[model samples]
Target chain A: MDKLTTVEGRAYPFGMKNVDTDIVIPAHWLKTISRSGLGQGAFEVLRKQPGNVFDDPAYAGSPILIAGDNFGCGSSREHAAWALADLGIKVVIAPSFSDIFSGNAFKNGILTVVLPQDAVDRLMEVAKTDPIHVDLEAQSVTTPFQDRFHFEIDPFRKQCLLGGLDEIGLTLGEADVIDSYEARQAQERPWIVPSAAPAVA
Target chain B: MVKPRTLYEKIWDAHVVERRPDGTCLIYIDRHLVHEVTSPQAFEGLRLAGRKVRRPDLTLAVPDHNLPTTPRRDAAGNRIPISDPQSAQQLAALERNAPEFGVRLIGDADPEQGIVHVVGPEQGFTLPGTTLVCGDSHTSSHGALGALAFGIGTSEVEHVLATQTLLLKQSKTMAVVVDGELAPGVTPKDVALAICGAIGTAGGTGHVMEYRGSVFRDMSIEGRLTVANMSIEAGARSGLFAPDDKTLAYLKGRPMAPAGADWDAAVAYWKTLVTDDGATFDKTVVIDAADIVPTVTWGTSPEDVVPITGVVPDPGSFEDASKQDAVRKSLDYMGLTAGQRMQDVAIEHIFIGSCTNSRIEDLRAAAALLKGRHVASGIKHAMVVPGSGLVKAQAEAEGLDRIFLDAGFEWREPGCSACLGMNPDKVPAGERCASTSNRNFMGRQGPGARTHLVSPAMAAAAAITGRLTDVRELMTTQKGMVA
Candidate 1:
């Protein structure tokens, strides 16, 4: 994951509400083991249509996306987030997001900014012409026309995104704490682990 | 005085190993169910980073999504190779990674191998008052047993494998209350679809939904599993029904359930897995059970639903233009006309299997409906894949397989067949199917394939009528017979 501070670029002003993960990247594209090269499949269905925002040359490689309510509302496939990042979308501004998709996006180093629908509507307007900017440190999205929208983000996620912290590595640092917890659980709940687990697992 | 906590709060408190000042919690995962499609990248990441699984005993891996539902062996019983090259590569990857990583791999031919969600609880790997996770979205299905289960992305999958814990945040709780009696012809799947429509797609975002009221309390464990399986469709991180006698009875004699003295101790803890009286919830949705009818999704999104007796709604009926436009796009993709009678909508195919409705009870219900009837001539394909090999065996033992097979339905091997486009069992383009699986998302069944989300009985009725017909129309007064 790359350290993300500010994402400033022309955004694909797609304001389609309830745009699910299947619409972001269809199930067929999920057969790959690798995460890269999925940009070709991002919004494959929508991109096939004439004059779709993703296919328009004016917004190619845009680093920000302004979307509508309930974006990324389906499958738990991180491929949806990977495809967005591979397509150069660093920030997605929506009124709300599905809980799992928001988490997946954060893990993939993509910023999901939840703004009021009015603010999102404003960004969608400005994105059609001017570039929009998002700052992690400030927790704000701003347009070139002096329209500034403050956002709320979890402090822990903010730190991870700004520093590109590896979550597993941080948790592994708490090995002692985890071990003691397991030890306590073993005493309290003997059946927690399969007692006769001499098998493969 | 201390504030009373809901079942969700109790589970969260029990699982938190450590809580950070930013409200983040390192919650220990008691169970992890793994499947092929979402885990290959996670395993590859572990290999690249030289990290080993922290507790392989707590993890169970099964090859479900990428493996074909076709026969796995020849007449001589030699294992057959997966025909699709891509799916074969993915299945082969899991086969190698699981044993190499010290995690159990339910082999492709293992009788226990099934949909990860279905196999987890059946094996008693999922328990009450525990935290469970899987890479697939329907992992919440295990919450039917009163666990704090939710789906995760591959990144979180690697996180759990490496640390046995996830960096999680506490979620608000919502209570979906349903009172009164369900109509005779209505089913649990109908109740779930009705809830989706009531809540809209994103209604449960940022919250853990707790199913409450008389309906859920009276539902069978399998019925509760079917309801909780669609929690993701409502945008909830998890949905759960409190563990009761029904949950304990369902787990009592299962292979992985605790034995002897451990059983008493486990049941004691499970009994504590309930909401406190007067416990406060962040949100509440009240659905009268009598209001629920035989329901089916009409458009691409799960929330785009109507009763089986209703007609396809016109996009112009929506007050919001964006929502109207979304409906219009969905109708355009689904190839449905506005105001058309839902029963008049025809289906060329029917699938009665998924984590949502692939248990023995679901199979029996479909078999009961198809006992003497046949698939309509207009239907091109009809298949009933059980949730697990054990379920298949149980069905065959009870002669349900005979009924399904005689009705022109393919009695296939157990796996997530045709529920997704990953495997070879896909509905062809421009065709429509009445599927017992969740998610009517565009192309979820196949490229440009239209799907109507329905119950097993409704799917069987569609198989008989070759269109979306209410099961009530074919159902009779017999206890088990749907006709």
Candidate 2:
């Protein structure tokens, strides 16, 4: 995870509602075990259309994306987030997002900003010519023309993003706590824990 | 008495190891289902970080997404190799990773291997009053059996593999109550589609829906599974039905379920997993079962739904300009005209399987409709891919395969064939398909391949007519099922 505090850049004005993961990164690109090189496949289908935003040189390497409601609405594939990150999208502003995609974005160090549709529309318009500013500490998105919109995010997620916390490392440090919990379950909820030994090749 | 808790609260609270002041809870996961597509990266992360799985026995891995639904063996009984180099490497990664991490792998040639969601409950790995997680979105299907299951990404997959616990914020509970009897020919798929239409795609975005009332109570386990499987499509992270006698009956003798005194104790605990009387939900959606018809999605999203007797909706009818734009794009991509009769929408392909509805009950429903009928001459391709090898075997034993084959449908091996089209079963470009899968997302079946979501019986009906027809017209008996 990388620290994300302030992201300022041109945004891809993809205002399509219900933009699912399949559209972000199609199923064929999922064969790769590694996460890199997905930038080439990001929005592959939409890029096929002439004059599409992703293919337009004007918005190339844009670190921000403006989308409509229910963005990333299908599949639990993290490839969507990976592709967005690989495409240099550091922030996504949408009216709403599917839960899985939101979590995936947070994990991949991409910021998902939720604002009202009106706010998103304004940003989408400004994205064509000017860079947008997103301040995580302020929980707000601002445009060059002084348009400011506030957003809400989970405080814990905000902290993790600001600090670039490695969640597994932090959780693993509490091994004793986890062991105690397991011990309690071993006594009270034995059926929940499998009795069979772990399998090996 | 303690404050009355909803079914979700009971299950959620029981799994909480710790709760932070910020409402972040470290919740224990009783089960983790993995597939080749998602687990490879997670396992690679572990290997790089030198982090071993904390509880390997709690995890199960299998190859489904990239594996071909074609035959697994040859006449000499030797396993056939995957021709696609990329897909073979993906499967090989899982084969190496699963056992190396001490996690069970239902390998490519294993008869027990199938889609993660279908394999979980069938093997009794998914249980009531426990928390389950998977990398696949349809893991919500296991929630039909009363498990608290939801999908996670590869990053979270690695987290769970290392700690067997997730740092999650509790989701608000929503009660989806249905009353009245479902009319004949209205299967759980119809009810699910109706629910999606009623509550748009993002209706339950941050909520876990608990299906309730008489309609769900009288429903079979398979039926509940069908509805639960589509919970993600309805924009809910998970959907649940309280464990009842039906749930117990479904799991009583499954291999992974407890036996003897353990089974008795498990059932006793499951009995207590229901919502208590007078419990409250954060949101409530009341549905009339009688109002549901044989429904199908006419456009891309699951929310773009209409009854069988209805016409393709005009995007201009929507008051919201953006919604109208979305609908227009969908109509154009689907090659449909506004006000066109849904029954007249011809289908070139028919797919009757996915994690959503590939169970035995789903197969039976299709077989009942296809017994003496045949796929229409104009229908180019039709396939029935069972959820797993076991499901395929069971269908073969019941002679359902004969019915499908006789009806001009291809009977295929289990795995998520054309549902996601990650394998060789992709629908061709510019073709229309009547699918029993959950999503009708753009390019979900294939790039430029239009997919219309429907029930198994309805899909079979479409195959017979070469168009989207009302399953009721062909139904001589109720073949209601949940998949």
Per-candidate Cα lDDT values, in order, are 0.91, 0.91
The CAPRI quality class of candidate 1 comes to medium
TM-score of chain B of 1: 0.98
- lDDT by residue (B49-90, candidate 2, tens digit) is 999999988888878998898998899989799998999999
Which tens-of-lDDT digit does each residue in B5-48 have in candidate 1? 89999999988899998889999999898888999999999999
Q: Give the per-prediction TM-score of chain B.
A: 0.98, 0.98
As a whole number from 0 to 100, the lDDT of residue B389 in candidate 1 is: 84
Clashing pairs in 2: B222-B482, B223-B482
- DockQ score, prediction 2: 0.60
Off by over 4 Å in 1: A196-201, B477-483
lDDT of 1 at B11: 92
Q: Where's the lowest-lDDT run of ten residues in candidate 1 chain B?
A: B474-483
